[model samples]
Target: MTEYGYFLASEDYGPNALVEQAQMAEQAGFTSLWISDHYHPWNDVQGHSPFVWSVIGALSRATTLHVETAVTCPTVRIHPAVIAQAAATSGILLGGRFRLGVGSGEALNEHIFGDAWPRTAVRHEMLEEAVEIIRRLMTGDEVSHQGRHYTVENARLYDVPDEPVPIDVAGAGPAATELAARIGDGFITMSPDREAVDRFRHSGGGRQQGQASAHGGMKVCYDTDRDAAVRAVHQRWPNMFLPGELGQLLPTPRHFEQAAQLVTEQQVADSPIPCGDDEEEHIRSARAYVDAGFDVVLINQIGPDMRGFFDFYRTKVLPRLAR
Candidate 1:
């Protein structure tokens, strides 16, 4: 069966709110949780970016829902070796219910560390090494390594998970899909592109029983007002609709907001996001990922309507989309 999951957007809510939302999501019949790991929100209007690990700890106590990072950038800001330790403890706290989803990140979060943001090629190189280091550390054995982008001296995860934490590497194209297939336990993507999923599966991704899986994420604004929902997305996530590397090039939320001024409401309306109170529209938007062959699709409800969105999905969307 295709599983449907709720996405916990750390950029849009505080840690406490996220914990509460986790409870709400489980009560509403969502099967899993997907949260983003970021040091900064995409734009100022999105408001919050609490440490995701801390929130995950809180979620561990609050709900039985399995949790996964939508996609974290472990190649920068923090060492992959360190992320390994965190993910290990997270798995233990959640009783082996944790998954780490990683990707090449945006400058909004990575640039704060004062390192020159490397180009895409270098970033991918870093990601490969990072994943290798994480996998070794997850084995609960002492590890040391020196690679093209990182160096690790004697490190190990003391509070290792009973079962290894699955790693999902995010990708957007054929090249990235191939990398995820080679290095990740599963593949993660933001869009519901069947072509990309096909590339990933053919390159040795998708379901393999004991191996790689496919995951996808989507965003929606569940408001009573359609235009108001458009305004919300245009203001908080115009970065989503940017054509190319603008998201990775912009260094801060302020920089993102400045660039987002170029994104019009019409563009936001034209984007493939589910908006307003139409149940069918919301279901249709989410179905794209399922239709693309994703084993699971994580749904994010943008703006300040979390309760309403959850209620609507519980009563309307989820039942209609149940597999």
Candidate 2:
């Protein structure tokens, strides 16, 4: 059975709003939650970026839903040792219902410290070392390491969870997917690409040792009026359509906004992302992920109608998917 989850976009909503959305998601029959971990929103129009760790703490108290950072960049912006501590605390707070989803990350968040962004290969190297450090620290044993990317000395987590936190790695291409297969407790990707899933499975990432298999996600806008939804998506999430490495290389929200101006409302309207109250459209959007062999499907709403989105899924979409 595929689990359906709500993706709480930290880039789109503030901490309080995210907590409320988590509550609403649980009531709406969603079984899990995926919250973004970002230091900046993609563009100013989306207009919000709260510290994801703080919000996760609040969520632990507010909702019973299992939570994971849709993906946090442990390679840069923050040291992986610190992220391990944070994830460890989060796991304790959530009573073992937490997953630490991590990735190579974008310059938009990681570049704030003025560290030169690494190339894709180097970033993967750093992430692999970081994941090793995190796992070592999570064992509640003292760790000291000297590596090509990071060095740690006399580091240990005092408040580790009874079971080590599961680490789900996010990937968008072959190199990253292979790394995820080699190191991850699970795999996460935004697209419903069967090839990526196949790559993970064949490249030694199959369900062999209790791996979570593939987890997928997509963004949709729900509104009674289709045109209004298109306009809203163009206004708020045009960054979604910015092609290629622009998304990974953009340094600031302003840069993202400047680039997003090129995306037209029509592009959003024509894309596969569902943007209206049409139940069939929404169902198909989610079904695509399920059909691609994803064990978990996470949905993120692109506009302000979160209440409407949850309600529509609760009363209409969820029932159909359940069948």
Candidate 3:
């Protein structure tokens, strides 16, 4: 069955605010939560980046909804062994309703240690190795790996969950998608691209036990005033409209701000993200993912009116989607 969830943007919200939003999402009928893991916001306007693991710990106590790191870059910025420990602790904290979503990583988060940013092929390789290390550690046994990208010595997680924590790999392109198929327990992508989902399922994915989940995430603005919503998105999330590898190549929020200046309000207005309180539009946007074979659709509100967004989804959008 397709389930709808709330996506919590760490770049745009503080930890407490995100937890409150999670509680409200549960009250509003959202069955799961997707939280972004980041070291910096895309721009100063989107200004906040709380450590995601800390927020997950708080979320474990705050809500019963399933929680996932919309995508964490386990390949860099942190070693995979440490990530395994974090994931294990998080799984126990969330009472097993936790999934570690990993990706190849962007320079914005991974380049902080003055390391040379790797090319796409190398990043994917590193990500595959990282996932392997994480899975091995989560087995509650000693792991000593000396791979090309990372090295771990005598590392083992003492507090693994009763069941191994699932790692869902994120993919935005063909090569990454295939890697996700081979290495991921589930798949994560930010679009309603049916072809990508098919590629994942047909290319060795969904063969373990049963069909693995295909999770799709998107951003929307829910407001009474359509123009106002567009302007808000233009101001806060212009980075959303950035093209090609720019999102992955940029090293800092300042660079993102500079690049985002090229994005105009008209671009955001024309993008697929549903804005305003048009119930049918929001319903249609989410339904696109379901039609594309997503098992879960995670939606993030890009504006300030989260409570209003929750109320709107609770009363109209979700019920209609349910039908």
Candidate 4:
């Protein structure tokens, strides 16, 4: 069976709002929670970036849903050792129901330190090393390490969960998917790409730990007015539609906005994001991920239609999909 979850966008909502949304989602029957950790919103129109750990702390107190960072970049802005400490505490606070989902970060958040953004290969190397460091620190013993991209000296997580916190590695391609299989406890991706999921499974992903989850997320703008939905999504997330490494290289919101301006509203209207209030359209978007072998799909309701979307999803969308 394919489980369903709600994705809480920290880039779009404050801590209190997110907690409220988690509660609402739980009441509405979501099985898990996915939250993004970002230093900045994708665009200014998205307009919020709360510290995700604080919100996660609030979530632990507010809901029982299994929570994971849809993907956190431990290689930049924050050191993996530090992330290890935070993740350890979160796991404990959540009664070991927290998973640390990680990935190679983007310049939008990783470049705030003024450090040069490494090339793609270098970034992936750093992420691999960071995951290793996080794993060692979770052992609850002192750790010291020196690697190509980071340095750690006698740092350890004195507080940790009873067991090692599960790692959910995010990937979009063959190489990343293979690496996720090598070291990750679960696989996380936004796209419904069967080849990637198949590669991970064939490369020794789900065999261990009984069955590692293949977690996916997607955005849907459920509004009565399709034009308004298109405009709002275009304003906030056109950057997601940027191809290649452009989204990874651009260092500022203005740079992203400039790039996003080239994206036409027609493109947003034509994009994969499921828009409008049609239950069939929403279900189809979700089934694509489930068909691709995802164990769970976290749906993000874009714009101001959260309650209405939840109502429709609980009453209409989920039942049909669950069958």
My TM-score estimates for the predictions, one after another, are: 0.97, 0.98, 0.98, 0.97
In model 3, the Cα lDDT at residue 267 comes to 91
TM-score of decoy 4: 0.97
Worst ten-residue run, lDDT, model 3? 204-213
Candidate 3, residue 235: Cα displacement in angstroms equals 0.9
Per-prediction CA RMSD (Å): 1.3, 1.0, 1.1, 1.2
In terms of TM-score, how similar is model 3 to the real structure?
0.98
lDDT of 2 by residue, 138-231 (tens): 9999999999999999998999999999998999999999999999988999998999999998888866356467899888999999999999
The backbone clash count of each candidate, in order, is: 0, 0, 0, 0
Q: What is the lDDT of residue 222 in candidate 3?
A: 94
How would you order the candidates by lDDT, starting with the best?
2, 3, 4, 1
Q: lDDT per prediction?
A: 0.88, 0.92, 0.92, 0.89
Q: Which stretches of candidate 2 lie over 4 Å from their true place?
A: 208-211
Q: Which model, 3 or 4, shows the larger lDDT?
A: 3
Worst 10 residues of 2 by lDDT: 204-213
What is the per-residue lDDT of model 4 for residues 1-323, given as tens digits with 9 covering 90 to 100?
Answer: 88999999988888888999999899888889999999988888888899999999999999999999978999989999999999999999999789999999889999998988999888889999999999999999899998988899999788999988899899888888998988888899888989989999899888446544698988998888888888878877888789988977888878888998889889989888988888888988999998999988999988787888788788888888888
Residues forming the 10-long window of minimal summed lDDT in candidate 1: 203-212
| lDDT score for candidate 1 against the true structure | 0.88
Model 1, 1-323: lDDT tens digits are: 78888999899899999999999999899999999998999887888999999999999999998999988999889999889999999999999789999999988899886989998888888999999999899999999898888889988788899888999999987778899988888999989989988888788775544543888888999999999999888877888987788878889888888887888999988888987989888888888888898888888888688899899999988999994
Off by over 4 Å in 4: none
